[model samples]
Target: MSDPAPRIVRRETHSPRSTAAVIVALCLAVVIAWVATEGVLSLLGLPALLLSPRGMLTSVAGAPDASAASVIAVAVAAGLVGVVLLAIALLPGRRARRPLHAEHAIVVADDTMLASALARTAARTAAVSADAVSVSLGRRTATVRIVPVSGTRVDRDAVRGAVTEEFTRAAPTRPARVSVLVSPAGKVGS
Candidate 1:
């Protein structure tokens, strides 16, 4: 009987939302520390001039009489902060590339690594210099652009097949559709 295939384990990673949560927590901590310090100092009969809670509230209460320009500036600053926070809350964090299932352990490759590998494979298959190839790896697609030698014609299908083969060997968890584009303008001296 054939041996059973080993299980593949994926690597654990933190999401961007977690990082943002940590940042928010730290900011809250700072605010809490300031308020606590101010309250303690006030109780000790040595209230901070402008940092105390009462002082801060009074400052806000008095802001209505501030110059128009200053008010506008403050409003703009607050708006910017709100926009940033909203973005952090709404934006999707970067997801690590899906892991490839293997016989033993799961394998993962960065998008850049996949692009480089595809580019190199395409270049070799097309018999062109590596610099003449450009590759873009997306979540569901891999695009390879190749510039053939000035006097030679490159077979697009051949390049595509080569890149696809290489991609299969890499064995990404999610298979990407391969696309090969041969540039109209060929490179000279390469």
Candidate 2:
């Protein structure tokens, strides 16, 4: 056996400093922008709010002489309406984000659909078959994984199209990512 060179681990070699700097700068920029915006808005609103309290109301008649009972009644009514609307908005959003009982999420999706779709698309493009397909559901997102069935060819474009077509019809919302795992051919167990 021949001697092999020692493997050098360079974690940052695969990534660039420019990309890291850009991402950091982007996050810092967003934070600074939000802070500046909030500061400016608060400063501008303070004068109108404190210097001229009467200006806060549309009508001068309702400012000083409004009875406490009327104010309480209005506050209660407003709170009730707000709570109802908030519940209506939040419940549906939460429900939509989660599968209706985890077991029922992928009723129609199966190993056959994914395998056949990838195989058919591969055959049409003269590409190699994908070994297996796995589907995952997340918060308002679904992901489909395609692993190469053989070493012949992995047509990423065709795979993406096939995966999108299948998910578009079945999933409730758009998928977040589709990853194609390239491995040695005939490794179906993997």
Candidate 3:
């Protein structure tokens, strides 16, 4: 029998600069401390090379410090770290956002004349705007009201139509209740 194909998976990638910088910062701290374990003087020598201007830092004229070997190694590591951090900084990261949703509910009654009522109710329920309130239907027996933006208007008849339409649209086996409420013009008095 043949082996099954390998599945491909998607992976997210992010800029390494922030991560690289953090890693380098940690490594640099360790390197400094490690040099001191050997001797304080070596620690002083390595920093000058690591931080100095370009040409002047090549290698000390003539013979190098016995500790120069470790200094060179540390410099290379720091350079590599710096590169990684910069690359990470340039990379993009992912952000998530959610879409807006309107409220919904179920309005219930006998299915006997639901189909007709739903069709007649289409226009009244179809218009939706920021000013317009959202409407829907599900099981039955429900009443809810909410603010429809000021310029936005809610038609009682249309609300009824929307619920009816949604209910009708459901398959015969999937009938649902309906109600479309437009909350008070401003606020519902306590």
Distance from true location, Cα of 67 in model 2, Å: 50
Candidate 1 lDDT over 18-121, as tens digits, reads 77778888999988888888888888989595587788888899899989999999999989988998988886554555455466654655668768878989
Q: What is the lDDT of residue 152 in candidate 1?
A: 83
Q: What value of lDDT does candidate 3 attain over all alpha carbons?
A: 0.45
Can you give the lDDT of residue 125 in candidate 1? 88
User: How well does candidate 2 match the true structure in TM-score terms?
Assistant: 0.29
The candidate that wins on TM-score is 1
The model with the greater TM-score, 1 or 3, is 1
Q: How accurate is candidate 2 locally (lDDT)?
A: 0.48
* Backbone clash tally (model 1): 0
TM-scores of all models? 0.71, 0.29, 0.25
Counting clashing residue pairs in each candidate, in order, gives 0, 3, 14
Tens digits of per-residue lDDT, candidate 3, 1-190, equal 6432211100111222455568778988998765444454444554443334322344544336638787788789979977876656775542121111123522233333443345334434534432333333223432324355455556766666556445545434343455555655643322
Task: Name the runs in model 2 displaced over 4 angstroms.
Answer: 1-131, 172-177, 184-190
Candidate 2's displacement at residue 143, Å, is 3.2
Q: Residue 140 of model 2: what lDDT? A: 36
